[model samples]
Target: MPIPPVILAGIARMGMTPAALIWGGDTHQELLCGYIAAILMAFSSIASYLPQMKETGKLGFAAVFITAAGNIIISGQQYGIWAYGAYAKEGLFVDITGMLVGIGMMLGTILLAFVTFRAKVFPLWNVLLFVVMLVSFGVPGLESWFALFWGLAYGAMGFTIVSGKYRNKEAAAANSLNLAS
Candidate 1:
């Protein structure tokens, strides 16, 4: 049997809590938590994509894949920084790469949000909250508070998914059809 979408989405959304802990301090433990958060975010992207796939198609898949890839890169960078102080201080190339990847991931996330909104697999309120959090990333003073906003947005989404507030009838029908064949 396939795992429920709620479980996947819920776990992915709640996983951001650890990532939020990065703001607690720059300790090695915090960095490791951030690394784990990246991995969870990667899986979350994949989880978020599943329900929307039938409606969003290849564009959605591309966005999810890019987001997942970006998360993986971020995870690796976090690990490198945590493991080697010299690497963090001297590796200009890694820093540049991480910045570029982060920007790419942000763009991919915007695209995914748009696609997901259009597909209507998730609730409008949750999507709007997510978009607002993303937009907050660009606001001068609000940038520092992004992690908190992100945690709230994803946490809301996770709760909604777990509570069965959002349903994808098309995906369900498709799954039933596939199972019968």
Candidate 2:
């Protein structure tokens, strides 16, 4: 594939935090980038769940997708709060609701990663990067790292799908079994 959809969407996520930093000067940039990130996040979440829905179960699919929605909601809420807060020249941050939402996002991601890893839907690297992404949230200095790692994880998954490595291996194994039988 020329450029995998996951890579593209991952790039969008990678842009989110930087976009937020530069968003201070104008609402347009912030709104534009933030919306793009949210849209991609939504798409990736769904894409991620599709394969799992079969190999793993619908419940895992639903969990991640729902949590991804929660993530989107949190993003939108933060953007608004930060934007307006900036406009007012206040250093204020999240409220109780936002905090709860943030926790929901983190918890959902961690849970999905665990489930997906256990299901072997994706490789362990994908799950590990997701855990890294989850951990990055707690460290302000590591804030940008989360998206970078996420982008890498998604890009890797995309490459794996496009290259047919895993699929072909499975096919080859099944063929061997068939011959033996």
Clashes found in each candidate (C-alpha, N, C closer than 3 A): 0, 0
lDDT of 2 at 31: 53
Candidate 1 similarity to native, TM-score: 0.76
Residue range 8-79, candidate 1, lDDT tens digits = 433443344454455444347656655766776777766566656677788889888898898788888877
Tell me how far the alpha carbon of residue 23 in candidate 1 is from the true structure, in angstroms, after superposition.
6.6
Q: Which window of ten consecutive residues has the lowest lDDT sum in model 2?
A: 167-176
Best by lDDT: 1
Instruction: Report the error of model 2 at residue 96, Å.
Output: 3.8
- The CA lDDT of each predicted structure is 0.67, 0.62
Clashing pairs in 2: none
Query: Model 1: clashing residue pairs?
Result: none
